[model samples]
Target chain A: MNDALPPSNQTQHSSDQDKPNTPITPNTRRILLVCRTAPYGNALARESLETALAAGAIGAKVAMLFLDEGVWQLAQHQKPQGIGRKNHSAMLGALPLYDIDTVLVDRDSLSKRCIDLAELGDFTQLIDSLQVKEVIADHDVILSF
Target chain B: MTLHTVNKSPYLSQCLADCLDRVSAGDSIVLIEDGVYGINCATSETLSALNKAIAQLMTLGVQFCALRPDIEARGLQTTSANCPFNLLSDGDFVDLVCEADKVLSWY
Candidate 1:
């Protein structure tokens, strides 16, 4: 039997909460991380979130775009307790603290999966195919996970 | 140009199709690991549909490639004359990765 507990907010000290946002210089790389996997049953989704936070921590301007099954990471009321996994959405809710404020979602992917935008919260910006194309062209670095 | 690597089979996953959908005109897609199955004669409905999508991307100048080592490991038969995409050795794959400004791996 496993007794491991999910990550807690205690790690984010109150002092750490007030840390100044990482400044982006003129030369800062605009990175786009396209996440296309679902949460749980695999580590890809968590890894994608970690990459976005890590990149943001290093002062790179980062944008996280969720497409296909990746949108599941943004699904509301996720209960991973039964599965013995951490709450994926809780980790995502911490993106802004790391300065990762840009989160895009493919409207088509959402529609196909029948997921309403309200369910994902207002943190995500809905983007169409044309917008997705433009976003891909705008980024200096694109990493798909 | 971006170097996109798809390491999953078209028959088993949606990685290749999704990658093709988002790729721009100048991007290159390298098929590695199980992705080599993409070029294995499209006799099924799924492969045919995926092949059509790939064909459309090819017309837009998206170069497709597969790793030779993985192909050999999977015992995939590919003669240059009949193969649709470039069969790359380990060194060539490294070169392709070096040439691209960024890389996106579809696992």
Candidate 2:
């Protein structure tokens, strides 16, 4: 954790400090949520999705990039119930409802894993390694999960 | 038999080689997560030596398997006639863990 940045909750209310009585202003910063972990085996994947949803709810301009094992979260036909966990892919389908429309998937990560677009559905913008650098450069704030 | 699991990419970490050094002829090795990238064309001498070590271990009766999901996620083809290791499904991975006397993870 970097000491320079405030915690998530603090960042959420940072805009309201000057006008305590007023409602929090809609966030204007462009946030890129970078997810790079596999789902089910750990909590990072779920935590990253929750963070994205939270930021989106605050009216922040949010986009998501699924890289490395993070692409596994987008895989279809996931039946996590046997493992006593909710279906992560189903949760991802809710991103658009939260106004997180700019979901990106690393093309190299998917191809390296043998996953085709059909397996991941049609919700994301596929980006190559170079485009990944461009997308990062385009964002104002990057939150890795 | 021991089951040694490697989950870090050999290109970026020392986990695979360290695991290789510790594995015996009868121990089993299962590549998972980024470790599955080991099957890709070697990009360094260390990786080539690791591959050679894996092959030599196989000749000495060491069983090697890579997780099917991780392998497929990385788009690696283990079904080819010349593929070096076997692919294990999640259930099979569970079985491999149960069959081994001990399990060591290098991640």
RMSD of each: 9.4, 15.7
Model 1 Cα lDDT, one tens digit per residue, B30-103: 99999987766333465677667777777899898889999888888764364458889999999999999888
Q: After best superposition, candidate 1 residue A71: deviation in angstroms? A: 0.4
User: Candidate 2: lDDT of A105?
Assistant: 95
Per-residue lDDT of candidate 2, residues B9-95 (tens digit): 888876677566546667788988888887652334556877677767778788878888998887877434666678899999999
Candidate with top lDDT is 1
lDDT, residue A22, model 1: 38
C-alpha lDDT values of all predictions: 0.83, 0.78
- Residue A51 of model 2 has an lDDT of 91
TM-score of each: 0.82, 0.51
Candidate 2: clashing pairs of residues: A112-B74, A112-B75, A113-B72, A113-B73, A113-B74, A113-B75, A114-B75
